[model samples]
Target: MSTRRFFAVALVVSLLVAGVASYYASSHPDGLEYVAEQTGFIDSAEDSATADSPLADYQTSGVDDARISGGLAGVIGVVVMLVLSTGLFWLVRRRGTDDVDSDDARPEHARQSEA
Candidate 1:
């Protein structure tokens, strides 16, 4: 498939998983939290600096519906990642050279030594 078509399909799938499948994710604490609780260190765990952020704890702030809030947070995360990754790729691509095999492109040591 064409690059554009491939990216379009990927983006659609990402959005669907983020906005729909996320609602079905397990509600229990993740591995780290579970381990901490079992080991009796849960009480010592402190909130992250970003605890007050709207998307903290995988739910949007002030959203009464748990499913909607989690889904929205997931979608926002996916979009942010997409934009950042695409921009990074664009920048790295711009710095690449089209020439693959050229003696002039290599350093002097890369060339065969004169007899």
Candidate 2:
């Protein structure tokens, strides 16, 4: 299949799985929190800068619904990571690619095209 079709199928499949998993997820604290509680460290846990973050605790502030909050947090984390990685790559690339037309470091085809 073409790139578009492939990506579409992947997205649909991923969404379907996510929906099913979300529907079946337990409302209890996740593995880490459970471990912390069992180990007697949960009470000592305090908020980090992450605590104030929009996606903190795998939930948004004021969200009463568990599944929605977790899903929203996951989505937000994905978006934030995508944006951050793209931004970092662009910044690094911009410095190198900005003057390809005028840069002597470029290859013959680029120099010829620019000329």
Candidate 3:
């Protein structure tokens, strides 16, 4: 499949999983939090620096419905990750060239001899 089509399908699947499937997730704390609580150090854990962010605790702020809040947060998270990763890939990606004599494609000794 084409790259664009692949990415389009991936984005749709990611958004659907984030926005719809998240509602079925367990309400209990995740593994780390559960272990912390069992070990009696849960209270000692400090809030993250983003504790006051709108998406804190995987829920959007000021949203009445838990499902909507969590779903919104999940979708937002997926979008942010996709944008950041795509931009990074674009920035670091190799640009193809038709020139065979490019310095990078030449052996070190040949480049030194030319210089």
Candidate 4:
């Protein structure tokens, strides 16, 4: 499939999974957190540096409604991921050929020598 089509599908799927499916995610702690609690070390865990950030804890801070907060956080996360991934890919693709001579710019002598 074309690159545009592929990216469009990817964005849609990402938004759907993050925004909609996240609402149904289990509220209970997962394996690591559960184990920590079971082992009696859960209280020792330090809060993340981002703990005070608006989007911390998978939900938007200060939002009165839980559903809206989580959904907004999910969509924001997806958009950020897409932007970062695309930027990294673009940087990688542009790195190697920036100063290389194009076919039309090669000297006739150089071209003949390579031939």
Model 4 superposed RMSD (Cα): 2.4
**Which stretches in model 4 have alpha-carbon errors above 4 Å?**
99-115
- Cα lDDT tens digits, model 1, 1-115, are 9999999999999999999999998889999999999999999988999999989999999999999999999999999999999899987776554444454677777665632
> What RMSD does model 1 have?
4.0
What are the per-model C-alpha RMSD values against the true structure?
4.0, 5.3, 4.2, 2.4
The weakest ten consecutive residues by lDDT in model 4 span: 95-104
Lowest lDDT 10-mer window, candidate 2? 14-23
Candidates 2 and 3, the one with greater TM-score: 3
Q: Estimate each model's TM-score.
A: 0.81, 0.54, 0.77, 0.81
Against the true structure, whose lDDT is highest?
Answer: 3
Q: Extract clashing residue pairs from model 3.
A: none
User: How does each model score on lDDT?
Assistant: 0.90, 0.72, 0.90, 0.89
> Which residue pairs clash within candidate 4?
none
Residue lDDT tens for model 2, 1-115: 8998996786666555553465476779889999999999999997797678776766767778877777666666555665798799999888768775458777889779967
Q: Rank all candidate structures by their lDDT, best first, as comma-separated numbers.
A: 3, 1, 4, 2
Instruction: For residue 115, give model 4's deviation from the true position in Å.
Output: 7.6
